[model samples]
Target chain A: MNVTDLCGLAPPEPLERILVWLDAAEPDEVATFRLPHVPYPLFDHLTLRPCCWDTTEQADGTALVRIVRQ
Target chain B: MINPEFSLPLAVPLRFFRTAPLWLLLAGVLFLLEPSTVLSSRHAPEALALTHALMLGFAGNIMLGALLQVAAVVAGVRAARAGLAGLMVWLGLQLGVALLVAGLWFMQPLLLQGAALSLSLTLLPLAGWLFVRLCRSPACDPTSTGLAFSVLALVTTVLLGSALVLVLTRGAALPFAALLRQHVLWGSAGWAGMLLTSVAVTVVPMFLVTPPWPAKLVRLLVPGTFLLLLAMLCWPVLMPLLVLPAAALVLPLWRLLQQSKRCVDPARWLWAWGGLNLLLVFGLSPWQAEDGILDAVVLGGQFLLGGLLPIFTAMLGKIIPFLLWLDYRRQRPLAGPLRHMGQLFPERWLKYLGWLALVAGLCWPWGGVAATAAGGVLLVYALLLLGMLRQACCKAVAALVV
Candidate 1:
């Protein structure tokens, strides 16, 4: 499911919150997670991380999980 | 990054020409009335009157009106009282200045007494109200900070003036000369110098499309200059402290010059001229005896007023045309290419005038009569600038209609 569908499934109160995170893989990168209802235009000029949902072990043997909004 | 909301007030943009003609007339009157006083005295009543005419009558009107207009334009808050507030301030200022000048010229105790009180009281509330309005606006910036300091300086200057009036009237109270010295410091350095510098910080960058001022310089250096002036006012013996702020100014000035893309503009050239005039003032700071002090004060005053102010006036000549064009274009869409500011005036003539004024100002101390003659030439130059401005405004309006 897309992030929007995931938001729809969640409680409305929690869906209204905005969550931000920094990517560990690229320390300089900033990520934001928001409800599907939020306007995309607001972030047009801004830098943001794409939402993902996966957990895997890299060739280096380090396990990684997709970060989600708290 | 181009914020339309950051525009200057409607009145501010036109003020240079509106007041320039009057200042030119006053310049003539000042020179004619007291040519001898130019290099021999620190405080002649006629000269003092002319000084106030330039400060309050000319510069004061333009600065205050422009500030009000700028605050409204930039902040997106219309003047609560609208045109009426502006009208009152202008009329009160003009009438007050006329009475004060007349009183000073005749040395009439009754006239000076009443005029001094009236002018002070009339302007005090207007300045106070403007300050309140600026503080409440969302567009408040460094320029506003300068205006606020200017208001404080005006208050100090006026109060000292009122005290001088009282000393003249009642002959009872603190030593008047000491108070007058403080008054001079507050009026010149605090009000005139600080306000001009503060506005220049923003204006020079915007006009030349220079890089943004370093954040530290804007936040620290500008306010530091004012603080030094304040210290000087409170402690006369600490007059030596003037050098501190004067030195601080060098960094921003250097940065401004380095950043400016349009080095050829005569207005930018005036910045150097004003700097030289200021340096001349500083150069004479070491004179010890009264006669030596008088000589320094006279020559310095000539450079500061006759030399530096005319250069500032020349810059305004350049600024007004572009402002007029912008205002006109905003009201109506243009179909073809727009003219640059240089096209609005006789650029060659302006350069010649600037050169003449600079040469005359530098030579005035050595040759008093010749300096006055140069002042006459400066007066004509000012009048010519006014005429050019008038033509530019007319052309812009016509273009907008077409």
Candidate 2:
């Protein structure tokens, strides 16, 4: 999980919006996010996946995620 | 620290993306001037040349360029020296396509042999390089594996294509029909189609605001496609099956787009058009058609509408705009205006291009004056697309400099 992964491809898909969410998210806290695209490695710089991280598919094909930070 | 090579300069893949439409332009002009030559039959030299121009010159260019971008962005790995590799392959393909098209048109054995040699040098090496880079990617995902398989397909296409060139030049003593079918199948459904389906999993979900592909489905699509291709060698009747997986994955995408609450888009239109054509053309065994002009039309129409044009249309309307804005943002980290794709280019023009591509795809099969008109229209479509892309580039640059 690296930030470089997030910076490589795709634009205009709420990437920046997700980053804003990450900025406001409580540090060392667990949260759930349903994003249109993977915000993992990009959010990994915040240590979002250092603990319990699970990704599953929604009926419409987006990712439903729960990250439990230590 | 990010590896310095993690991202190829924006210019690297964009060069191929920009250059692809030129091939379509050349194909349309060639078909227009030599309508009779192209309309005669599927076996006609002119028709063969035209197909090569659209297939290798146009489709191949986009596939290679996109992979370089996808590898770095999606898979978290980069092709070392992508710019140099892209340049060599670009020059080689241009020369090879020119020589091959001329050879097919003039029925010149020496030129055909030379074209084969040139393509071999370019495509084979590039495929190897790409395959290695994809394998080294940090992300172990379906897209990466599918890309590796697609490169293998490219290698296979080159080998068979070169052999066919030798056979055409009378340099080889072998049967032609079986080998030709194999070649077309591997190149179209295997290399191009596989790559398209693989990319669709991410591109459709991400850009279109549609549901992501079911993980189970995405994981098996590429490897299953390859196995089907391998089996086709033993059972020729399975040729139609080669297109089935791609059609299956994309058909649902169209339905998803229809049900999507996202705003209307020309890119969506192009993708839907492609999905429809894929079903119409490859839904059945094309070998069942009797030999004649109609058969030629069906085959060519299927690949053009079902495979190439629709794919490129989506790419142009959707991917290019995002790439442009991404580059612009890199320049203005703080005060840069974040513009949506519709702001960069009018959606009306793209929607028109979508219809134009659809009309041209449908019109290609009706030979004679209609075919000529179709070619002419396609040429216009290609030119307009190139113009719009260039404008996008210029605007992005202006924003950066200003």
Candidate 3:
């Protein structure tokens, strides 16, 4: 749910970049990111167990992310 | 503690998802078996029948079914009396669509009346229920906003469609072309496209590991597209340009997909095929600038590849496996190797299906023998998908029962 937890998962560089973006995503709009390979459990966690966000997939394997920070 | 509340039974959504391919196959058969009737004229009764199978039967069914999930998950709302509502809405939709297709194909007044009556009995209340839930949901993000508008467009699409049906019944020789254009504009662009855009903002990123649609585009794109479509009502020239922007969205996403690291995924390729089809719809605009059979072919390909089928293919890869996994996890109670979405239906098969879809898409508008060939390929694609899902269901059931 937090960046430190994501750091603990040690996602590859591509995914880490998405996490970094998610940290700074603007409100009420989508921020799409892509991964080279199917990511680890941490990416799945962010998708299914979003703390204050929603995750979607594009036609390709790119990730379209939106966060709702309280 | 992001424990999302499960709303409708997976059965409700799965039933609709599962039925989708069958209807499309029926569409293919209708298209193939009556190619002369269907390919010869855009206004042919047989042609309309083929379209209905795709529109009301295939696209509408999937969208409505997926709507329950989107409403529950994204909008923080649920269908009222989920079980009964699901059944009533599904039944009404299937029957109404069937009658309308029949009425149009045969030009039967009674069937048209029955179609209108069936939809009146079912679509209005169901749409209203969904509309209320979506409008009232606390989620105020772009996806939810787009969804709320999409539902409104659905209401308009249905009413306009009903009016057309009524016109058919009255035995009046009115210039229904304008009304028909309006109806298609709202139905596909306003309702279907809007909802697709809404879902894309959510599902595309989560599943494909892709970037979200730019917030500004998500905000301005959907509503702006719908309004422009509305403007096209008085100005028919707007027709060619309507879906161009929505389709243009693919190029940037295609660039992003080039950056995706998902090495073994077929979704990226399928999506690319879809985007290419959208581009082609406009790119080949000069061949049949006006509304001719060639133009119909281009539009048909856009809806099939760019619009509905590609997304359906991508979502099936996500949803069916997820549903089965959820059941396996919840119902098994014993320790076993749970299947990932990839394991249940491997990426290779998706790749194969993707190829078939591409071939079928190309063949779809060629007419005559080529159109039949497209149907053959599409039939295989649909059967493969449905068969895989059916196998997964059986496995899930076996696990649950034991």
Q: What is the TM-score of chain A alone in each candidate?
A: 0.22, 0.45, 0.41
For B71-189, candidate 2 gives per-residue lDDT tens digits of: 66666555567677668878898899989989998989999998999999988887887788778755566777888898899888889888898788875886688888889888878
Better of 2 and 3 by TM-score: 2
Docking class of 1: incorrect
lDDT of 2 at B25: 91
Estimate, for each residue in B1-402, the C-alpha lDDT of model 1 and write its tens digit: 111233444454365347645765675667666777644555777767666666676666656655554444333334455556555666666677777777776778887777776778667886687677667754435665666677777788888888988887778577888888778777766776666666665555555545555655555655776677667666677776665555555446656766677667666666666665665554445343345423654555554555456556555655565466455534542222334555455567567667756755665555467667756765776676667667777777676656
**lDDT per model vs. reference:** 0.57, 0.72, 0.67
Error of 2 at B336 (Å): 1.1
Error of 2 at B376 (Å): 1.4
* Backbone-clash count (model 2): 2
Q: Which stretches of candidate 3 lie over 4 Å from their true place?
A: A1-70, B1-6, B172-174, B282-293, B305-307, B332-336, B399-402
Q: Candidate 3 residues B65-160, lDDT tens each?
A: 777767765565555477777888888888988898888888898887888888777877777877777677655667777887788888888888
DockQ for all models, in order? 0.02, 0.17, 0.06
Instruction: Flag regions of model 1 displaced more than 4 Å.
Output: A1-70, B1-17, B69-78, B286-297, B334-339
Q: Rank by lDDT, descending?
A: 2, 3, 1
Question: Number of the top candidate by lDDT?
Answer: 2
